[model samples]
Target: MLAPSEVSPRSLHAVSPMSSPPSELTPRALVAGGLIGSVLAVTNVYMGLKTGFWESGCVLSSLLAFGGLSALARRGAPLSPLETNLSQTTAVSVGAMPASAGLLGAVPALTFLGTQPPGWAVALWGVGLGTLGVLFAFSLRRRLLEEEALPFPTGAATAELISTLHSTGSAYAARARGLWVSGLASVVLTWLRDARGLVPAASLLPSTVRVGGIGADGLLLGIGWNPMLLGIGVLVGPQAGLSILLGSLVAWVGLAPGLVRGGLVQGADFASLSSWLLWPGVGLMAGAAATSLVSQVRALPAALGDLRRLGEHGEGWESTAGQWASRAVFAAILLTLGMAWFAFHLSPLYFLLALVLAFPLCAVCARATGQSDIAPISPVGQLSQGGFGMVAPGQPGLNVAAAAVVSGAASHTSASLWSLQSGRLLGASASRQLFVQLSGLLLGAAVAVPTYFLLVSVHGLGSQALPVPTGLQFKAVAELTSHGLNGMPPSSTLATGLAFTLGVLLSVGARGKLARWLPSAAAMGIGFVVPAYYAVTLCLGALVAVVVGRLRPSATQTVQSAGAGLIVGESLLGVLIAALLALGFLQPPG
Candidate 1:
């Protein structure tokens, strides 16, 4: 039998009793949320395509909404804290959708398969699938939030921030100040690095760091002084950052030169080299991920049990299937099935499997986020491909597309819970928050749909300007497996097998005592995939944080906050530059 405390409504992060009813979710606020969400969603797409990572829309949305509401307050009327939460809840739901790993990452990868889907299809597909995610999130809320009490660090931070900001309208000043300073610094540095037309470029380091006449690039190199990477490294922590470094060294130093010298590969460039190197890196990472999941098989049944007992509380949307929102989700999922069949040519069986898989995959993604604030989403899509390909073989397009839907839905599903967790803590109406999230999704689709196609039409999908790593992965795996392994290159097959074996051993070996020294197999795999410049710059940030955190542990939050500001700053500016270049307002700088 379960303990009473385990199933109780009480929580370490539960809402306090309120004296007054929380402020209303007004039309103006809803519109504001949608509009803001659209901008953020566009930014997300731009950044995701550039960096192959998507930062949370929560903190940034909260910060922007609070500032806007505060500014409006100075003039005349202002939003209450609850209203702010509603607005932000809406913003994050929509903001994270457009450039979602599932849609922008997995779907756009179809370009490699000679299948470039239209923006309307992508948009409709995203909104429909994302709606299912929102529904999945709420249904899991009772277990994940109330009973099980997962940490959900981002949600907690946002909740505390909303409470603090509303209660005293003062703390935001320091955080905002930190945000802008770093943001502006990043913008300036990016312009200099990208647009400053210097001969041989404005590199912060000297040409060579020669050790025994081999040169560090040959010996696998040191860190780069890049702001965006530094920010990510700091955010991901030293261990993950270092693992990326190790992966980069193994690929570039230990592997690349030998491959080139032996005439196994043609180019030494990041883009060229990642094609071959990332195979093993991805295999290693994928193998580790699969092993980690398989190792936890005993816990699966209990999680499913917790999930099925969702509405036992006899309250909220889950308990009442009569709710319009509930019906909307059902309708969306059903309609999406039709869309998949006619538009995407996916089979009906794949949709059923995607739904069944959503329960477990969604749980995994949400729990992962709650624990580490990182969601390994692409693997879910990959897993979907692997699972479906066996039962229904040779339909590569259908398999990958179905996987995209599942992963895409899972993305929104996990994200919605986090967005609403803050709202619930702030005493916003559950129905209202749900509505806001849905509205944001619709608005995000409006913006993201156009932005995606525009970027593709102007810049091209696989272009160096936008080297979407996830898209490449989705494209590669779908084609490789579905098209038949017998037709694959001999070298590629050997490399993948070797990499998979290496990944399994290293990951499995990282038990108990050996954990800290090894770093994340996933991060190392990413290091193999992305540019050396990215990994190098990230190391710099991680190194700085490690050094500073040890010296001044008290100020780590402030520093991390500033690092976040740098990321947003650089991302916004980078998008602006990309847009300008696309429109012919600015020519290629380098």
Candidate 2:
């Protein structure tokens, strides 16, 4: 979720290098990065479970590495920029595990379908997918980073932040301190609201108002109390925030009452409503994703050309990473294939097809990330699911698992390439970065999956506390594909078809001159699945951000830093509360 920075790659390197560059892969750097990355991995899992979004912790990780390394440098050797870059790269890789390892989307979706795999298998599967992404990044490093010189704004910004921090005194410390302070505030707020029960969980709409004779008592409508949703609103900007609010209004206030009055959907809680709502939501998301991919067809020619070049100079590509790296990538491919067969009972042919589809899909994700700073990861997964649905029809497990391979690998590729972009600017060794990133992937999977298990144990999937929006989307798609149109209620089927067409139209409209006028089809679709309270809180946060930006533009970055802190802090605390509940140390509130 790193916003695209306008900073040019060349402009960042204008600053002078260090008098003496440090080692690229020091033991201290590795250990520190592993620790911070592990924390980040946990935070992302918590955040993804709650909100279905995760941030790439590159800038935050860089600041953290600097803070820790600077403290260590006081007694020992001075801090080195290259070493910090490597550490941040490692941390970024590990931090991205929730999305890249399928913990957020695919694995959870399978769990929802009553097919939870063992923790060890999940970890191995994640490592395999993540390593596959690192391989893909290695293959494209020359083309995307060197030959084409894509800006990769996030990477460029990290390089700039590192340079700025090293050159200027007090700036990095101030920013890092601000992050901690913001996080502390979030921690206290979450504890007070969730643990002590001093704060209300939600604010309900006025009961006097009626829509189709369904008032506040008849429909679940309110503004939630989670600071994380507000933080998400701030980070996502007004467009996406408003889009989610729009979707919530359409789904809850508009559609829910009608569905209930017509007896199409039963119950008022999130679970019962989402069971029916997920159909249109998933359809809308898939339609938008397909349209977005189609819009990128122009990149297909250049992509094919890049592939042709890669085929022609395959040896040169191997020379960049060396023969050992090649062998490792092969091992990763084999690991993925083996895990698919052993863990998920996925057919080898289907798994291979997912990988075959992954090549182009990874390119699509990378290009989207590079261009817009928004990797269409969910959409990419939808495309994969759609393909598998066609070939391996009526197999829910195969559909979800195969899409997991594609989405997980693509997510990793996007993250790694951006991290490599920072490395490219700082002149760090590509091979070393690759090695550390691979190590980080394994470390991330080790921590994130278990944390997920702990949360699910306490909160349970589809609960209000852990809606798992992305998981619901994936599960909905798998069910729809396996059962076709005959499986759903007639009204729901009609809604899904209409939502799909609307999604396609909205996505198509966003590509042209009126792009700014359109809402994000994806975020709106997400709003359909999450509670209305979340959307209300998100909109309020977005409004607060807009007011601050207009009143004090200089504080925009400060606000964003705080927003990021709010997300991480509350999520970490939520995880702690979950653990405490699981251990019988904390009781669930009445």
Residue-by-residue lDDT tens digits, candidate 1, 456-563? 666676554566766766666676667656555337778877777777777787766887877777778777776666677787788888888899886676677777
The C-alpha stretches of model 2 lying farther than 4 A from their native spots are: 1-19, 206-209, 305-322
C-alpha displacement of 473 in model 1, angstroms? 2.2
Model 1, which residues run further than 4 Å from truth? Answer: 1-20, 27-32, 76-79, 99-101, 168-170, 193-226, 302-322, 371-373, 457-459, 487-489, 505-513
Cα-based lDDT for every prediction: 0.69, 0.82
Global local distance difference test of model 2: 0.82
Checking candidate 2 for backbone clashes, the offending pairs are none
Q: What is the lDDT of candidate 1?
A: 0.69
